[model samples]
Target: MSGIPDNLVGLHKHVKQFREKNDETLFEELELFIEEEKVRRKLVLERPGELFFFYKEDYIVVTEELSKIPLTAEEFTGSSSLLRQLNEDQIDMVGQLTKELVILRSMRMWGSYLSC
Candidate 1:
Protein backbone atom coordinates (compact mmCIF):
# COMPACT_ATOMS: atom_id res chain seq x y z
CA MET A 1 0.00 0.00 0.00
CA SER A 2 2.99 2.31 0.57
CA GLY A 3 4.31 1.79 -2.96
CA ILE A 4 3.57 3.79 -6.08
CA PRO A 5 0.32 2.98 -7.89
CA ASP A 6 2.21 1.44 -10.82
CA ASN A 7 3.95 -0.89 -8.38
CA LEU A 8 0.58 -1.90 -7.04
CA VAL A 9 -0.53 -2.92 -10.54
CA GLY A 10 2.60 -5.03 -10.86
CA LEU A 11 1.96 -6.62 -7.50
CA HIS A 12 -1.62 -7.36 -8.51
CA LYS A 13 -0.43 -9.04 -11.68
CA HIS A 14 2.06 -11.10 -9.70
CA VAL A 15 -0.55 -12.13 -7.20
CA LYS A 16 -2.95 -13.10 -10.00
CA GLN A 17 -0.29 -15.28 -11.54
CA PHE A 18 0.43 -16.92 -8.21
CA ARG A 19 -3.24 -17.74 -7.81
CA GLU A 20 -3.43 -19.13 -11.32
CA LYS A 21 -0.44 -21.37 -10.51
CA ASN A 22 -1.97 -22.44 -7.18
CA ASP A 23 0.98 -21.36 -5.06
CA GLU A 24 0.41 -21.96 -1.33
CA THR A 25 3.17 -19.55 -0.28
CA LEU A 26 1.56 -16.78 -2.30
CA PHE A 27 -1.79 -17.54 -0.71
CA GLU A 28 -0.30 -17.22 2.78
CA GLU A 29 1.48 -14.00 1.89
CA LEU A 30 -1.67 -12.54 0.37
CA GLU A 31 -3.76 -13.55 3.40
CA LEU A 32 -1.28 -11.78 5.68
CA PHE A 33 -1.37 -8.67 3.48
CA ILE A 34 -5.16 -8.74 3.42
CA GLU A 35 -5.33 -9.01 7.22
CA GLU A 36 -2.97 -6.06 7.59
CA GLU A 37 -5.03 -4.07 5.09
CA LYS A 38 -8.25 -4.90 6.97
CA VAL A 39 -6.78 -3.60 10.23
CA ARG A 40 -5.54 -0.46 8.47
CA ARG A 41 -8.94 0.17 6.88
CA LYS A 42 -10.78 -0.52 10.14
CA LEU A 43 -8.61 2.01 11.95
CA VAL A 44 -9.50 4.62 9.35
CA LEU A 45 -13.19 3.80 8.79
CA GLU A 46 -14.32 2.79 12.28
CA ARG A 47 -15.41 5.52 14.66
CA PRO A 48 -17.41 5.86 17.87
CA GLY A 49 -21.17 5.75 17.40
CA GLU A 50 -21.42 8.89 19.53
CA LEU A 51 -19.38 10.96 17.04
CA PHE A 52 -22.21 12.99 15.51
CA PHE A 53 -20.11 14.40 12.70
CA PHE A 54 -19.11 10.94 11.46
CA TYR A 55 -21.99 8.50 11.63
CA LYS A 56 -21.27 5.50 9.34
CA GLU A 57 -24.93 4.70 8.62
CA ASP A 58 -25.72 8.33 7.95
CA TYR A 59 -22.81 8.58 5.52
CA ILE A 60 -24.00 5.50 3.66
CA VAL A 61 -27.57 6.75 3.52
CA VAL A 62 -26.47 10.19 2.35
CA THR A 63 -24.31 8.76 -0.41
CA GLU A 64 -27.13 6.49 -1.56
CA GLU A 65 -29.57 9.38 -1.69
CA LEU A 66 -27.07 11.61 -3.42
CA SER A 67 -26.47 9.01 -6.11
CA LYS A 68 -30.15 9.16 -7.03
CA ILE A 69 -30.08 12.92 -7.49
CA PRO A 70 -29.87 14.08 -11.09
CA LEU A 71 -26.68 15.87 -11.99
CA THR A 72 -26.76 19.42 -13.40
CA ALA A 73 -23.89 21.26 -15.05
CA GLU A 74 -23.98 24.10 -12.50
CA GLU A 75 -23.80 21.77 -9.54
CA PHE A 76 -21.54 19.02 -10.79
CA THR A 77 -18.64 18.31 -13.10
CA GLY A 78 -19.40 15.20 -15.04
CA SER A 79 -16.79 13.28 -17.05
CA SER A 80 -17.72 15.07 -20.29
CA SER A 81 -17.35 18.44 -18.59
CA LEU A 82 -13.97 17.48 -17.25
CA LEU A 83 -12.70 16.41 -20.64
CA ARG A 84 -13.03 20.00 -21.94
CA GLN A 85 -11.19 21.65 -19.03
CA LEU A 86 -8.51 19.14 -18.05
CA ASN A 87 -4.98 19.32 -19.33
CA GLU A 88 -3.27 16.07 -20.29
CA ASP A 89 -1.54 15.73 -16.93
CA GLN A 90 -4.69 16.64 -15.02
CA ILE A 91 -6.68 14.11 -17.01
CA ASP A 92 -4.08 11.44 -16.31
CA MET A 93 -4.17 12.24 -12.62
CA VAL A 94 -7.95 12.08 -12.59
CA GLY A 95 -7.91 8.75 -14.39
CA GLN A 96 -5.45 7.37 -11.86
CA LEU A 97 -7.59 8.60 -9.00
CA THR A 98 -10.69 7.02 -10.53
CA LYS A 99 -8.86 3.73 -10.98
CA GLU A 100 -7.69 3.79 -7.38
CA LEU A 101 -11.22 4.52 -6.16
CA VAL A 102 -12.70 1.63 -8.15
CA ILE A 103 -10.09 -0.73 -6.74
CA LEU A 104 -10.78 0.48 -3.21
CA ARG A 105 -14.54 0.00 -3.59
CA SER A 106 -14.09 -3.48 -5.01
CA MET A 107 -11.73 -4.38 -2.18
CA ARG A 108 -14.18 -3.11 0.40
CA MET A 109 -16.96 -5.21 -1.10
CA TRP A 110 -14.90 -8.42 -1.30
CA GLY A 111 -12.56 -8.04 1.67
CA SER A 112 -14.14 -10.95 3.55
CA TYR A 113 -13.24 -13.33 0.74
CA LEU A 114 -9.69 -12.02 0.69
CA SER A 115 -9.19 -13.01 4.34
CA CYS A 116 -10.19 -16.57 3.53
Candidate 2:
Protein backbone atom coordinates (compact mmCIF):
# COMPACT_ATOMS: atom_id res chain seq x y z
CA MET A 1 0.00 0.00 0.00
CA SER A 2 3.01 2.24 -0.14
CA GLY A 3 2.92 5.20 -2.51
CA ILE A 4 6.02 5.58 -4.58
CA PRO A 5 5.98 8.22 -7.25
CA ASP A 6 5.95 6.78 -10.76
CA ASN A 7 8.97 8.91 -11.69
CA LEU A 8 10.85 7.90 -8.55
CA VAL A 9 12.93 5.25 -10.25
CA GLY A 10 14.23 7.79 -12.75
CA LEU A 11 14.83 10.38 -10.06
CA HIS A 12 16.91 7.88 -8.10
CA LYS A 13 19.07 7.10 -11.10
CA HIS A 14 19.34 10.76 -12.16
CA VAL A 15 20.43 11.93 -8.73
CA LYS A 16 22.93 9.13 -8.38
CA GLN A 17 24.43 9.89 -11.76
CA PHE A 18 24.50 13.60 -11.05
CA ARG A 19 26.38 12.96 -7.83
CA GLU A 20 28.89 10.74 -9.55
CA LYS A 21 29.44 13.29 -12.30
CA ASN A 22 29.87 16.29 -10.02
CA ASP A 23 33.54 17.26 -9.66
CA GLU A 24 33.00 20.18 -7.28
CA THR A 25 34.79 22.48 -9.75
CA LEU A 26 33.87 25.96 -10.96
CA PHE A 27 33.22 24.72 -14.52
CA GLU A 28 31.44 21.59 -13.44
CA GLU A 29 28.80 21.49 -16.12
CA LEU A 30 26.50 23.87 -14.27
CA GLU A 31 24.14 24.17 -17.22
CA LEU A 32 23.89 20.44 -17.59
CA PHE A 33 23.11 20.17 -13.90
CA ILE A 34 20.36 22.74 -14.22
CA GLU A 35 18.92 20.94 -17.22
CA GLU A 36 18.90 17.67 -15.33
CA GLU A 37 17.01 19.32 -12.51
CA LYS A 38 14.49 20.75 -14.93
CA VAL A 39 14.00 17.33 -16.44
CA ARG A 40 13.31 15.91 -13.01
CA ARG A 41 10.75 18.59 -12.26
CA LYS A 42 9.21 18.20 -15.66
CA LEU A 43 8.56 14.55 -14.97
CA VAL A 44 6.36 15.56 -12.06
CA LEU A 45 4.77 18.48 -13.84
CA GLU A 46 4.05 16.65 -17.07
CA ARG A 47 3.25 13.32 -15.38
CA PRO A 48 4.37 11.28 -18.35
CA GLY A 49 3.13 7.68 -18.07
CA GLU A 50 0.64 8.78 -15.42
CA LEU A 51 3.35 9.77 -12.96
CA PHE A 52 3.06 10.92 -9.34
CA PHE A 53 0.22 11.27 -6.81
CA PHE A 54 -0.37 7.57 -7.08
CA TYR A 55 -3.71 6.15 -6.07
CA LYS A 56 -5.88 3.03 -5.97
CA GLU A 57 -9.48 3.22 -7.14
CA ASP A 58 -10.72 -0.26 -6.35
CA TYR A 59 -10.42 0.38 -2.63
CA ILE A 60 -13.07 3.07 -2.67
CA VAL A 61 -16.85 2.69 -2.79
CA VAL A 62 -19.46 5.11 -4.13
CA THR A 63 -21.82 5.59 -1.23
CA GLU A 64 -23.81 8.31 -2.90
CA GLU A 65 -23.86 10.59 -5.88
CA LEU A 66 -20.90 12.90 -5.81
CA SER A 67 -18.73 14.97 -8.07
CA LYS A 68 -15.03 14.20 -7.63
CA ILE A 69 -14.36 10.61 -6.75
CA PRO A 70 -10.68 10.10 -7.53
CA LEU A 71 -8.75 13.31 -7.53
CA THR A 72 -6.98 14.31 -10.70
CA ALA A 73 -5.16 17.30 -12.11
CA GLU A 74 -6.92 19.68 -14.43
CA GLU A 75 -4.28 18.79 -16.95
CA PHE A 76 -1.16 16.74 -17.37
CA THR A 77 1.55 18.85 -18.93
CA GLY A 78 4.75 20.67 -18.05
CA SER A 79 2.77 23.92 -17.96
CA SER A 80 -0.25 22.50 -16.10
CA SER A 81 -1.80 25.22 -13.94
CA LEU A 82 -3.09 22.79 -11.31
CA LEU A 83 0.07 20.75 -11.10
CA ARG A 84 2.09 23.95 -10.83
CA GLN A 85 0.33 24.62 -7.54
CA LEU A 86 2.60 22.12 -5.80
CA ASN A 87 5.07 24.04 -3.65
CA GLU A 88 8.79 23.48 -3.46
CA ASP A 89 8.54 21.66 -0.13
CA GLN A 90 5.94 19.26 -1.46
CA ILE A 91 8.10 18.40 -4.44
CA ASP A 92 11.16 18.05 -2.25
CA MET A 93 9.30 15.56 -0.04
CA VAL A 94 8.90 13.19 -2.95
CA GLY A 95 12.50 13.82 -3.99
CA GLN A 96 13.77 13.03 -0.52
CA LEU A 97 11.77 9.80 -0.39
CA THR A 98 13.15 8.83 -3.77
CA LYS A 99 16.67 9.44 -2.50
CA GLU A 100 16.04 7.32 0.57
CA LEU A 101 14.50 4.54 -1.47
CA VAL A 102 17.52 4.64 -3.74
CA ILE A 103 19.76 4.20 -0.73
CA LEU A 104 17.69 1.31 0.55
CA ARG A 105 17.71 -0.34 -2.84
CA SER A 106 21.46 0.03 -3.02
CA MET A 107 21.73 -1.67 0.35
CA ARG A 108 19.85 -4.70 -0.96
CA MET A 109 18.01 -5.05 2.34
CA TRP A 110 14.53 -5.56 0.90
CA GLY A 111 14.23 -8.86 2.77
CA SER A 112 11.52 -7.32 4.96
CA TYR A 113 11.12 -3.58 4.42
CA LEU A 114 9.17 -3.58 1.14
CA SER A 115 7.99 -5.88 -1.59
CA CYS A 116 7.87 -3.45 -4.52
Score every model by TM-score.
0.25, 0.23
Give lDDT for model 2.
0.35
Candidate 1 per-residue C-alpha lDDT over 1-115 given as tens digits, one digit per residue, 9 for 90 to 100:
4422433344546454356545556557667766656654564567432111112112221233343343334444544444333333243332232213324345543343223
RMSD of each: 13.5, 16.1
lDDT of each: 0.40, 0.35
Across residues 15-51, which tens digit of lDDT does each residue of candidate 2 receive? 5447633444313544444555555556556654332
Residue 96: error of model 2 in Å? 7.7
Q: lDDT score of model 1?
A: 0.40
